[model samples]
Target chain A: MPGPDLLSSQGLRLDGRRPNELRRIRCKLGVFAQPDGSAYLEQGNTKVLAAVYGPHQASKSKSLQDGVVVNCQYSMATFSTGERKNHPRGDRKSQEMSMHLRQALTAAIKTELYPRSQIDIYVEVLQADGGAYCASVNAATLALIDAGIPLRAYACACSASMAWRNGQPEPLLDVGHVEEAAGGVVLTVASLPSTGSIGLIEMSHRLHMDYFDVVLSRAMQGCKDIEVILDRAVREHLAEGWTKQDVVVI
Target chain B: MFQVRKLANLTLFVTTTPTKRYNKINKSDCFENSILPVHFSVYFIFHRTKDYNSCKNMTRHVKIRLASERVNHSVSSNNELPRFYTPGEVITGMQDFMRGHGTYAEDDSLKASVAGVMQKVNKLICIRPLKSRYVGEIGDVVVGRVLEVQQRRWKVETNSRLDSVLQLSSVNLPGGELRRRSEEDELMMRKHLQEGDLISAEVQSVFSDGSLSLHTRSLKYGKLSQGILIKVFPSLIKRRKNHFHNLPCGISVIIGNNGYIWISPQEKSNLVEGDKDEIANVETQTVSRSERETMGRVKNCIAALVASKMMLDDTSIMFAYEESLKYEEVKDLLDTEAMLDVAFLTQHKINYVDED
Candidate 1:
């Protein structure tokens, strides 16, 4: 079984989509003033607030690095999901997410510029509908910008799931938890969309050897499509200035 | 007579009124009408009137919309505003200050304010609403409710957090220099004043903790010589602490925002129709504190009488109160155990609830 007959007979995936369409994305930057940078992003009903702390100093134990060290912390609020979790962070899942976040974020950051310093990225999921990791990455990207951290390009992540329709391979973008639970081959790709290069790719569940490239490319394309929207938002945000209207006197 | 017949019908007098239709039960049974709910808002839901067969316990839902009708003066009360507010954050619906991240301190001069942990950590927040009260400054007109008779003075519950003292000298009795009101004055005073009476007064001085000390040493405000009284929430009456408010036709005194109103008719009656007109003028022409107390009592009586379906104007309200006040028999009945309890009404097989 190429995973539980992923596509329904109506040519729709488990969550009802024509496979390639992505979930809605709503993002806001500079939502908080205390932090160097902050952003609020909602991918569908999943909401995440990302805050960037520093490029300041390398604290005692974790100091020596050849280049600027990227530290990422991923935590979810207890009430964010349908089944509330007892612990917000320090869980194995969150630890794994932190590692994955560093890998993708480091690819997009110009880490060499600030040698021996640390950039701390913290993402907290407030509400979780689905595609939480992708949302965290997108939100963190905006927060890094708000923190005035240097980036090579906007780092956007999107997921694609392969739904095996009647004799044809269908691709689903931004697979929600419901669709993921429905047992499709989910392929998540984190990339610098403009450069058309994959920063990170992870797949759960197995598809045909030949269909892997198609699924991976579709996920990458979803990332690129998201980058365009996010870049436009960032430009508009920077051009318009911060929210607490900067008082100007002529 | 024809108007009475028309009012008896379920359908109102072809011309619709918000209160007239629902007030049939109120007018016929104008006993001691005390409006239970002080807060009247868009969200005021009418609860089902439960059945309890008794006289004292009997309660009917009475809602009256009195737009117009004139009255007397009252003393004004006030509330102290916080010296400072949280920057960018708003304190809404209640007394609690909303502490946002933006609030800052100016070294030792400013206080360090932080949002309470539980308040911010939780998803829901609750704030209790506060009613506005009177702040006694240099000079302000206020309305006060006579709470207790102490010596020659009456302790008037002004809208301020503190109770004000209404001295005997400030009140205008029939003769100007009628030195010392006696026990006979307390007994016969209901003819001129009583419990729950609304009177308009003036803020003589501030009694330390922002409470008002009132005086009505003026002709315009003193004793309910005439006109109606009303009781309402203490917050609605807005008073600008000033002396002498002379309106076009008459004068008005703002009692604390609560519902105490003392209204005396202007010499020339500028005739108007319905409760709609007076509501527009509630904040106009400051009623003295003493007059507000007098008027608030009358409005309560009207609210009760009107709620019970009695189409009584200023004349009938006074008639009922006068009839009830001077009646030694009714006062005696009020003392009886059977009358005090639900026993009498229940024995008579009347389906009513007792006053709890």
Candidate 2:
């Protein structure tokens, strides 16, 4: 038996959505004023808050002649996850997250305009479910846009998983904590969903060589879906006129 | 008196719980968050961990300077306690503290990066969890106490800088007049709910100023009964929600990840039976029997350490909860497959009944 009752006989996943359905996405930009830019986003129970501190002076070590140094820090709240973490940041896991963040956001930000400058994009994950990294990248993108930092396009991220239930390979969308822990093949894609160009993609565990296309395609589809939602949020945030996220005077 | 100084990392006036309270830093300046409270005060600057360690290693002398008072010092504690530093003066005191007793080498940028904090005559001490968590955010579920009830709204002290308001309308008795009362419900005058009623509520909003407002809307989040409430450091409790499901009918345990937990009999169970420890080996204290019970394993070790007064923190909680989880009742509830699942021949239900 592959697995009991992950996809129902009706062909819906555990949370009763079709295999293609992503989690509910609700986002708001300008959630806070104390930062140059800020945004809060909720994807299912996963909540992420992002604050952009500067396009201020570049530190001596970080300055680049051709572009701005986009400094990104990703920190999950200690109580954000089911398991309690002793230290929230400055830890190895967070260091890895920080590095991943810098990688993803540096790609997204158009740094050439702000040459010899630094933009600090700090992402704080208040609550974490499964897709924290994807949520962080999405939230940080919104924060940078809210901060009025120029970007190539919305850098949206999403993850997909595949479980061969009932002898047929089924691609899962926006994999949640349960499926993630179930040791399925997870494919995470960070893409300029508008143009269908992937910036980053990671896979955990292995899948049948044949199932890679379906899984990667579903994850890219998730990225495109996320880009729509994020784009709408950016428009609504811009249409609302003055947002608090752009007003961090300090 | 120009109460010109706000106590930042550097400025504090530790008096002998002193009578001569002046904003002008004379000889009686105290260290910030006094390690010792009385007699002498020093204005030590806030140094980072490495910085403090380096300074502690150095025996170099630093000069102390006092600013000339714009107003002549008249900090008279009249018939009433003196209104020492005006708020503006306190802010100024904080600024002066930020400017650590002037030195050619002093760097304002270094200290300014650290938030300039100030406090009263007795350095207002703050328990900053360097890794401290933010207490509450909007829409978070929290369990708190009705510490000071005024009007219709009860001031609930959630895990935050200030207490939040839980209006009477948000809560219902077994049955109440209003199905759901409007905001018109008088906050200052409540129909029911006195001080000290332990209630469960949702954080409604966090004011820009960092105050909180909570609501007790759901049937599940309301008055607690039939059990005890334990308060620990809010940060100690994890702030994630999980259904402690399969809770025995007689017991309903509402644990706030914020370390405030409310336990009550589910209108079925009574607690009079008391927590009788079927603790094996209390009489004999042997290895074989003690190892059989998880509590026996830890109770012996921790009691030894505590008897020796070795301070315990995270490592201890892990060890303690690990052992505690092994109890048949707890293992049944927790089902920690990784740490637990050691077979005990005698089949029994899990202990430490956890209600999700």
Candidate 3:
């Protein structure tokens, strides 16, 4: 009974959020002028920056005849986490995260159209608040959109956690660092929300089969909510730069 | 043939209706500001822990603004903003229209796959994003840097997604026109254009995979020396019959379609017909202090226009130059206030011309 309390007696989560409440997502596209596309995204206390370059001619070693190659790199700054880290990138954990990011983003990108081309996506986590991977994925999606790359739909990612209240199991949306360190089961999901299909699913702790559906559904729903926010940002960005003369009528 | 909407004309001509326009502006401002949440202090769950510094770091200096606050404010377009589509938004049914770039067909609907304004030409629909990598078209004048000197070609980076090719066959061989390229000429490729050297060329052809083939066969197109290069988004450059201009203010500007612009002191009439040797000698010739000042002013003026998202062409550029004369020194044009003033005055001049 001495464990950290994930939920209070009144049913609000530890962070005073409801079971279905998400972290506040604030994002901006075209944050950098040098990259083909760049975006900065902040989710709660976590902040991420993503940049995308190319769809250009690929090198001989990496070129593919049938589809485009997606290259991803995930690096966390030394100051991003509670402990200072030595390496910013090319570590074992960063390598795995890079592969995972490529897998999720490639599913949403229309890669077949750009044969013999490569798209490089680099994500830098400037701050970590437990859902850094999810924030990185979301930031990469925005950067790709800013680059004007063709995509099947908006790719979104979210993390969910499970807790018990009065012996009834409930799922929490958008888990932060505090709950993540409490030895709770954290389920992360990346999906194309518009298409209603999940691209990647990762779970940190084992959970009972009976409660799996609840947690997965919560994560998917978080993705859908994130899709709405990201879509609004893209539309607003377009409206800001759009002019009446760009469209031709014939 | 897209017709400019009458509302755009009205916005320019109907300046007399200040009350209604003022109300509309205020209403739009309210709508934009209301969408974003008010800024609050950062939330830290582990306040009782040993590290209070981390909590302070979370709230550190984040400049959050609503999307509307990032708009280009140096100049406002008279044209009404267009309807925008995001990825997966169904633009139209797939039955009648052919899908183009930045669009895809899914579930019997033609959806936009990029965020931009939609354009319909005949039976084809395309989305033109506001900013993207340079997509080359034939006959486009582009400024590029030599990236690598390969067998019979020099790979040039023209701000396009791909490295463009400048073949030896396509170049003027630095001596004369109608000269056949030889093995000796191939060996001398690097001597003519080495790595990191800038050159202005014409886009001769586009490859099937979207790479451009550039040619520097004309007298106007060749190795550029002693000029400041400025790059802007390709979409901001307006396509016109002439991309090169010799401004009356004693500076020459080459507005490349790839968004790499070159500004240099205008060559005197005597220097125009210089050969390779004479051209090399001209490089050593000292450019007068006045000419250098004029060149810097032209470069800064173009930067001001680019910052405002104004259409970049010779006329608008010249207008910006004329408006920038109020600034006594060339370096002063780069300041925020002067940059905005020059852009605003140039936009006014452009609108005045449109009215006439």
In terms of DockQ, which candidate is strongest? 3
lDDT of 1 at A87: 88
Query: Local distance difference test, per candidate?
Result: 0.57, 0.56, 0.85
Candidate 1: residue B303 lDDT (0-100): 44
True contacts kept of each: 0.00, 0.00, 0.69
DockQ of each: 0.01, 0.01, 0.42
What digit string (tens of lDDT, one per residue) describes model 2 on residues B1-356? 11223443433433221233334433333334333333333443333333445444543434333433122211111122211110001123242332321111122221111111212233222111111113567766677777776666777766443466776666664345366555545542343555777777777777654556787777566665334555433333433454122132223455564445554434323333334342221223332322333333333323322222122233332344454444545323222231222211110111123121
| Residue-wise C-alpha lDDT for candidate 1, range B1-356, written one tens digit per residue | 01222122222223222333434534333232332322332112222223213312433333233223211111111222212221112334323433322122232222112111112323223111111123356566666667777667777876444467776656666544566877776665556656777677777777544446678778656544445555433323334344233322233333333335555544324536345556346435565665444444444433433222232223334443443333234323232231212222221222121122
lDDT tens digits, residue span A167-245, model 1 = 7777778888887787777788888776677788888876779988888888888987888777666655543331111
Name the Cα RMSD for model 2.
29.3
lDDT of 2 by residue, A1-250 (tens): 2344568878888778788889999998766646667888988889999998656546668778787787778888989999997888888988988888888777766566555567788888889888898999999888776665545567889999886666788888998877777667678888876556777888888677888999999999899898878867765543333111111112
Off by over 4 Å in 1: A2-6, A242-250, B1-356
| Model 3 misplaced regions, further than 4 Å | A1-3, A243-246, B1-74, B272-277
CA deviation > 4 Å runs, candidate 2: A1-5, A242-250, B1-356
Q: What's model 2's overall lDDT?
A: 0.56
- The numbered model that scores best in TM-score is 3
**Model 1 iRMS:** 22.8
lDDT order of candidates, top first: 3, 1, 2
